[model samples]
Each structure stands twice: as structure tokens, then as C-alpha cells.
Target chain A: MFAPVILSIKVAAIATIFAFILGVFFAHLLTSRNIPGTSIWETILILPMVLPPSIVGYLLLKVFGKRGPIGAFLLDTFGIQVVFTWIACVIAACVVALPLMYQGAKAAFQSVDETYCLAARTLGSSEWKIFWTVKFPLARPGIISGIVLTFARAIGEFGATLMLAGNIEGKTQTIPTAIYYAVATGKEDEADVLVLIMTLFSFFMIFILNTWLKKKNYKVS
Target chain B: MGMYFKIKKKLAQFQTDVEYSFDKGVLVIQGESGAGKTTVLNCISGLKTPDEGEIRIDDMVLFNEKTNIPVKNRRIGYLFQDYALFPNMTVEKNILYGIKNKPEYRDRAKRKELLDYAGYMMETFRISHLKKRYPANISGGEKQRVALARAIVTRPRLLLLDEPFSALDARTKETVYEEFFSFKASLGIPTILITHDPRESELFADDRIVMKDGKIM
Candidate 1:
């Protein structure tokens, strides 16, 4: 009963960390530098959000399944497995929720006043120094809010997590999967409780995040 | 020390083609708005590359057809019309932002020296009291002083003041002008100022140019 709840939190937490790091990295890269094919990079990052969860799961399976290159290499080299495990749950959740964090970071970076960056540049600051001291501080609130939203999205990840990680009760059976199984098995009471818990958690997290962001960034224009 | 640049660039609505040189004092460029005064400063500071020209400060080329130095390496100071102070940082941090990134200040002894110098600049600007206050919390005049402090703290070879006093009230402008002139005389750095204020023009026009349609007249 509690297994799914705990695993759900664990998976979402780990997934959010990975998503936050990668999302911010890519966001900064795309924003700061004039890399060729920027639109293509944006499209790739945004694909997971646009695609159906089932398709995303299939794609992950191709990469992480036993016969897949990554799976074969890991199995032979490290004796580790990914598919139908807790790790797979994290991977699916991260992929599906990454776009939220990425878009958030991109918006955050864009919202930073260009004058501040220009001012930093003329002040004998290296591009690296300017980003850390000027850009990052200005974008921190937005990025942290992105992390929270990503966590909520990761925790509620469903079809992809279902298809990739499968419903192993103690290993990868997160709340979404647990809810699905309970409803399918006509255990309506258990599904009801899990649904209520997720709803309450997401509402409070997002409400607090929005309120905090409003306070931190008071200028509407 | 001296600085010179010849910029030939086409903006969406205007083409700026101008050349000028200045020694160690304020060289004012007075013009109506949209006269491309700020664009010239941008080119000199390496923020905007001219379509064709050379910018040299202290006889070192900053931009040309082949030699284009990056903005960070140009060691040019600029105060934008809006002051452009980093809102997240306090007044002291904003002033110290430049020297802290300088390679020479990386060592302990030089770092301390630069810190002391920055403290002096804040005191000179009379913004020492607002050291811990953020830019958003400060008055427009204070913000300009903070920006000016940040600009000169690096000991830049050339300083560009782009309508630095435009945002201030008439009373605030008078005080800032005195501070600006004193800072300029004490530092003896070459300066290019863009201004619509006749008072600023009369006060600091050590070498003055009137720009009409991006050409110096």
C-alpha cells in the first residue's frame, strides 16, 4: 500500500534532479551561445512533451531493453539491468517531465535583462563569469520553480512509466501504476486514496511556487 | 592615453559612418535622439561590431576587418542610459563586479587592493551608505552612481557614458555632473559621452562633436 507512495516520491525526486541539471545545461547553452541548428535542438528537447507517453515509452524501450545496445553494454560490462526496474521508472519519468523544466529554464534565461549581461561583458567579465554572477542569479527563482513543476510532472507520470518500468509492486510500482492497477482490479477505495494524495500534494506545491515567484518578481512588465 | 574609432554600419533605419579621436578627457557627442550616438559607443565598446572600421584604444586595435577583440577583452567601461545595474546584487557588489572578474585581481594581495579601491570609489560616489541596498531599492541617481562605480572600478582604459544622466532629475543631474567631472579628472581616463544635456556638453566638452544623421559635423 505504502510501497507505491514511497517509490513514487523516490522516482520523482531522482528524476527531477536529473531533469533539472540537464534542462538548465541545455537551456543555458541554447540561450548564451549561437550554436548552429538551435531550432533543431529546441525541437528535440520539446519532442517528449508533444509525443504520446506510449510512444516515448517505446522509444525508451528500444534504448534500454535487454537486446538494445545500452542494455547489452551495461549487462556485459557492469552486470546491471534497466528495463522493468526502478531505474527505468526514473528514466521514463525524467524523459516525460524534462520538457517542463527545459522550457521553464529557457523562459527564465530569456527573461533576464540583456542589459545586465551587456553591462557584465563591458565590465571585464568573461562569458563564464557573467553567466554565473549575472545570468544565473537573475534566473535562479525561475529555475527553482521549474524544478518544482518538473517534480510534480514526474510524480504523476503514467503511460511511459507503466510501459517501461512495469508494475512490480516493491520495485517500480509508483502511485500512477498503483492507481491503474487498483482501478483495473476494481479496488476503487485504494485508487481513491492515492488520487486524493497526489491531488493535495500537487496543489500545495504549485500554489506555494506561484505565490513565491510573484513575490520575488514583483514587476509585472 | 587616447582612443579612436571609425565606424561604418547600417542600422535598420540609418547608416552610421563616423570617425573621431579623443585624448584623456571627456569628448562629448551631443545630438538629438536617434542620431546614432549610442550606436557609435556600442561599436567602440565591442558590444556591436561595425560593418567596417577599426577601433583602437591606447594604440591597440579592438575591432577591424580582421582583428575583432571580444567585449570582455576590450577593457572598455560603459554606463548605459538605464544604468543597467545588476538588480540581484547590492550596490557594493555591483561596484565590485568588474575587478573581481579581472585576472590580475585573482591573487590575494591584488584582490585586497582592488577591494579597497572599489571601497574608495563607492565613497567617492557617496554611495557607501547604500552598499548593502539592491539597485531596485535605490534612487535613480544612486543607481547611476553605482553603475558608474562598477564601470570605472576595473580601471578601464576607455570609458563610454551613454546618456548616463538622462534618467536623473534636474537637481540630481547637477550633482552627478560634478561627480563625473571629478572622477574623470582624478582618473584621467579617456571618455566618450553621449548627451542631449547642454549643461553636460558645456561642462565636459573637452573635445566636442555634433552629430547630424550619424555624421560628425
Candidate 2:
């Protein structure tokens, strides 16, 4: 039980990192005027956040299963398996958590004054440098909040991990999966303890994030 | 330094047709709201591509019908009406934002010169104490000073100020104007400032261009 809990936390952390990076890129792309089909791409990115997690997990399995095109390529060339592994849990968590990070990052980036960016450009810094130095710094609060939210969401993920990675005890069984296992086997006391821990952890994260956001004057709107 | 701009473009609510040349002096653009002064400045700085135009700064052709340079290559400093300072950055970071990544000069000399200039301007404008404050923590007048400091820090070939004093109090505006002229005299760089105040134009401009309905009137 202890091992699964620790492993779940690690998986959630890694998944949050991946989602946060991709979320920043996607937010920038969505807001940039030069990118074509931005609206369509944004809608697709948000689908995972809105649609049922079970649907998302099923879709992931179809695309990344052992016989699927990408899965087959990975197996033949890289000798790597994706489905029913810890990696699958990470992938599932990232898909579910992407929209939160993207929304937060997009709002943060958009809030930066265009004139500041223009000033950087006029000073001879390239586009990449301007983003890293000026834009990213100004948008730090939003990015930080986004990371926290993504991490919390990934940690609480259940349906997607179950469908994609399965409840392999001490391997892919996360806190939520462990709770589900405990309840199914009529282990009421164990289930209660696990649920209490997960709930407290989530509440603490959210409370801290809210306080930080308020102190930094980060409005949700 | 000198710049020449000839642009013709159509927007949803307005159209622009401007042709002008600027030399090393204060060239003021005066007009009512929505008169396309900002658009003209944007075109000159390569922030907006004109459908038909040519922009030349000194010997370099910044924009022509056949060649369009990006904004980063234009090397033209701009001061927005809102004094768009990064809200999350300290004044030091805001001022150093432009020169932070240049490979040619990464030491403190340029930064020192800029800070010195900012200090002089702050003393001139009485904003010396606000150097460490963030944009959101400062007043409108302080924000304008920081914006001005940031704009002129890089010693741009052409400095464009768009409605710079519109957001300030009268006293702050006067102080900003005084600091501006002193800075202009020191740098000797060509400047094109936008204003709706006839008195401001009369006081500061060597040549005043009146823009009306997107055309130079």
C-alpha cells in the first residue's frame, strides 16, 4: 500500500511536468496570430478536459495498445510497451490534466502587454529570448498555479488509469486504484484510510494554491 | 538618423495613406482619436505590414514592396500610451529586459549607462525612489517614467511615443515633457511623438503633422 501511494505520487509529478511543458507550448500556439487552424486545435486540446475520462482512456488504449500503429512501432523498434504499464498511467494523467494547464498559461501569456514584447523585439532579442525572459517572467504566477492544478488533477485521476494501465498492485495501482481495490474486497477500514489521505492531500494543495493566487493578485477571470 | 515611410492599407473601420520623412529632431504627430497615428507609427516600426509602402531608416531599407523586415530587425523603440510595463517584473528587470540576451554586450556597462540615464530622468521627473517598484505597485506617472526609461535605454535609431502623456496628471505630464526634451537633447536621436494636445505639439514639435481620417491633413 505504501509503495503504490509513493509510486502514484511520482507518476503524477512526472505527468504534471510533461503536461505543463506541452500546455505552455499549446497556449502560445493557440494565441499566436500566425498559426493556422488555431481554433480547431484549441477545441481538440480542450476535449480531454470536458469529455468523460473513460472515453479518453478508451481512445488512448486504441491508439497506444500493443497492436495499434504507434504501439506496434514502439514494440518492434524500441522494445517498449506503453499500455498496461506505469507509462500508460502517466499518459492518461497528462491527457486529463492538459486543459487546466493550457487555460491558465494562455490567460497568463495573453495578459502580458504587447508593448513589452515589442520593446524586447526592438532591442534585438530574438522571439525565443523575448518569450523566455519577458513573457515567461510576467506570466509566472499563472504558470505556477497551472502546474499545481495539473499536479492535483493528475494525482486524483482514476477512470483513465484503470482503463489504460489496469490495477496491477504495487506496479500500476495508484491511490485511487488502491482505494477501489480495498472497497471491492470489503476492506472498509483500508478504503477509508486511503480516501481520507487522498482527500486531505488534495484539499491542502488547493488551499495553498488559492492563497498564493490571492497574494499574487491572480484573478481567475 | 532619418526615416521615410509611405504606406497604404485598409482596416475595417479606417484606411491609412501616409508618406513622410523624419530627421534628427522632435517630429510630433497630432490628431483626434482614431486618426491612424498609431497605425502609422506601427507601420514604420514594422509591427504592422502595410499593403503598399516603403520604409527606409538611414541607408537600410526596412520595408519595401518587395522586401518586408520583421519587427525585431527594425530596431525602433516604441512607448505605448498605456506604458505597458511588465506587471510581474521589478523596475530593474523591466529596464533591462531589452538588453538581457544580447551576445555582443552581456556585462553591466550598458545596464549601468541605462540605469544612470534612468536615474537622471528619475531625478529630473522626481521618480528616483520608485526604481525598485513593480508596475502595479506604482502610480500612473511612475509607470510613464519607467516606460520612457525602458524605451530609450537601447538608444534606438527612431523613438516613437504614442499618446504618451494622455494617461498622466497635468503636473506629471509637464514633468514628463521636460524630461523627454532633456533626454532628446542628450541622445540627439530622431523622435516621432503622437499627441492630441495642441499645446504639447506647439511646445515640443519642430514639425507637426496633422492626421485626420487616416490621411495626413
Candidate 3:
């Protein structure tokens, strides 16, 4: 009864952690440097958010499929498989959730006063120190909200997870996949229960996010 | 012991071409909005790169075509037009921040000495009472003093002020100027101040460079 729910929570938590790390690093990179073709890079990072989930799933499968380059390398090198597994579910969730994390962090970093960074530099602080002490703290509220959004997106992922990891019962069946299965099989009672749980979970996360942002005097316009 | 730079940088509207050197006292760069006064300070502090130039503070080469020292290693203290106080830190923490990451701090005795120095700076700036207060709660003049304290706490080789008194009122400006004069007298380092206000210029400037359309006159 609770296997899918527990699996969804685990996948979302791990995916959110991965997204947060990549998102913060990429956000800092994109904003701090005068890299040529920055806008194109930003657009590429953002593509998964707008692309069809099935397309994202298809791309993931291609990269991680047993016959693909990366997949074949892993198999030959380490005797590991990635496709159609719980790991693939996590990968799918990370891809879909990453854009949210990236966009949020980028905006947060951009909003920080450039002068503070310059001031820190002139005060004999290394670039690494300035980022950890000055930039990160000032941008914390926005970054936290980004993390929450990523977790929400991760747990709610469906189409991509179904394509990549499949709807294997007890193995990779997340909340969304389980709900779909219940509805398609005409198990209306089971579907209703799962829907209630998912809705309540999402509402709780959003509620926490709103409260935190408000406490930090951040108003969403 | 002096600072020298001959820099040329092309802006959207004009090209900056200037050559100057300053020994020990305050040198004021007086100019209008588009005269590239701030850009000069940015170049000296290693915050911005020039198309062609060599910057030397005393015997150290801060910037040249072949070599550019990173901003942190340049050891310049800069007070921005906006103060740029770390909004997340308390006044005391902000003042101490400049020295906290210094290599000297790795030594236990040196760390204690720096902390003592920070306390002295807080007392000197009259921010001892506001030690726990965040920048958002401090007044404009108090913010400036705190910023000044933070800048000079590192014992920098040079000091750069970009209209440091622009935000203060007449009364606050007078008090802040007095505080700055006392601070400057003690440091004995060269100062480059960019300000359009003639009164501010008259108060602290030992020498004045007039800039018009990015050219020194």
C-alpha cells in the first residue's frame, strides 16, 4: 500500500540533493563569468523544463541504454546497469527538477549587489571566501525556495519516470506512476487515496516554502 | 612611497586617458558624471582591467599588459558609493571580516592580534555600541563609518573612496569627515578620493586632479 509513496519520497530527496549541488554551481558559473554565448548555455540548461517529458525520457534512455556509449562504457568498465532501474527514476526526476533549481539560483545570485562582492575582494578576501561568506548568505532565501521547488517537482515527476524507469511495481513505481496505474486499471478507490496523499504532500511543501520566504521578508509578486 | 598609473580604456562614449602619481596624502579626483573617475579607481584596485596600462603602488606592480595581480592580493581598501556593507553580518562581524581569512590568521597569536585590532577599530569608529546591529538598522552616517572601519582594518597599502560622503546630510557629513580625517592621519597611506562635491574636496584633498570628458586637466 505504501511502497510507491516511500519510493517517491526517497527518489525526490536524492534527486533534490543532486539538483541543488549542480544548480548552485551552474548558477554561480553562469552569473560570475563573462563567458561567450552565455545566453545559449542558459537556454540549453533550461530546455528540459519546456520540452515534453516523454522527449526528456527518450533522451535519458538513449544516454543510459545498454547499447549507448555511456551505458556500454559503464557496463564494460564497472559491470553496472543504469537503464530501467530506480537510478533511472532518480535521473529523470533530477533532469526535470534541475531547471527550477537553476533558474531560481540564477535570479537570486543576480539580485545580490555586485558592489558587495567587489568590496570583499578589495578587503583581501579570496574569490572562494567571498562567495561562501558574502554571496551565499545574501542569496540564501531564494536558494532555499529553489530547493523546495525542486523537491516538489521531483516527487511529482511522471511521464519521464515512466518512460525511463517504467512502472515496475515495488521497484520504481513512484506516486505519479502508481496513481496512473490505479486509474487505468479502474481501481478508483486506490487512485483516490494516492491522489489525496500527493495533494496533501505538495500542499505541505508549498506552505513551508511560503512561510519561510515570508519570514525572510521576501514577497512573491 | 607613491602610487602611479597610466591607463587608457575605451568606454562607449569616450576614451579614458590619464597619467598621475600620488605620494602620501589625500589626492582628489574631481569630475562630472561621465568623466571615468570611478573607472580609474576600479583599475587601480584591480576590479576592472584597462585596455592598456601599468599600475604600480610604490614598488609593486599591480597591473600591466603582461601581469595583473588579483584584487585580493593587491591589498587595497575600497569604500564604495553605496557603502556595500554585508547586510547579513553584524557591524562587528563586518569589520572583522577583512582580516578573518588572511594568511596571518592561521597563527593563533596572529589571530588574537587581529581580533584585538578589530576591537580597536570598532572603538575608534564609535561603533562599539552597534556591534550586534545589522547594517539595515544602522543610519547612513553610521554605515559609512562602519564601512571605513572595515576597509582600513586590513592595513591596506592604499585607500580608495568613491564619494564616501555623498549619502550623508550636512551635520552627519561634518562628523563623518572629522572621523575620516583622524583615521587618515593615523594610516599615513596614499588615498584616492573621487568626489564632485567641492566642499568634500576642500576638506580632505592635499592635491586635486580635475577630469573632464575622461581626460585629466
What DockQ does each prediction reach against the true complex?
A: 0.61, 0.51, 0.55
User: Model 1, range B42-105, lDDT digits (tens) per residue?
Assistant: 9999899899988888779889889999899888889999988888887888888888778878
Which candidate do you rate higher for DockQ, 1 or 3?
1
Q: How does each model score on TM-score?
A: 0.94, 0.91, 0.95
Model 1 lDDT, residue A103, Cα: 95
Number of the top-ranking candidate, with DockQ as the measure: 1
- Candidate 1 vs candidate 2: the lDDT winner is 1
Per-prediction interface RMSD in Å: 2.7, 4.0, 4.5
lDDT by residue for model 2 (A161-218), tens: 9999999988899999999899999999988988888889899998998898778762
Pick the winner on DockQ between candidates 2 and 3.
3
lDDT of 3: 0.90
Sorted on lDDT, best first, the list reads 3, 1, 2
Chain A TM-score compared with the true chain A, each model in order? 0.95, 0.93, 0.96
Instruction: Name the candidate that leads on TM-score.
Output: 3
Stretches of model 3 off by over 4 angstroms after superposition? A217-221
Candidate 1's error at B125, in angstroms?
0.9
Q: What share of the true interface contacts does each candidate keep?
A: 0.73, 0.57, 0.73
- Runs of candidate 2 with Cα error greater than 4 angstroms are A218-221, B101-103, B107-128
TM-score for candidate 2: 0.91
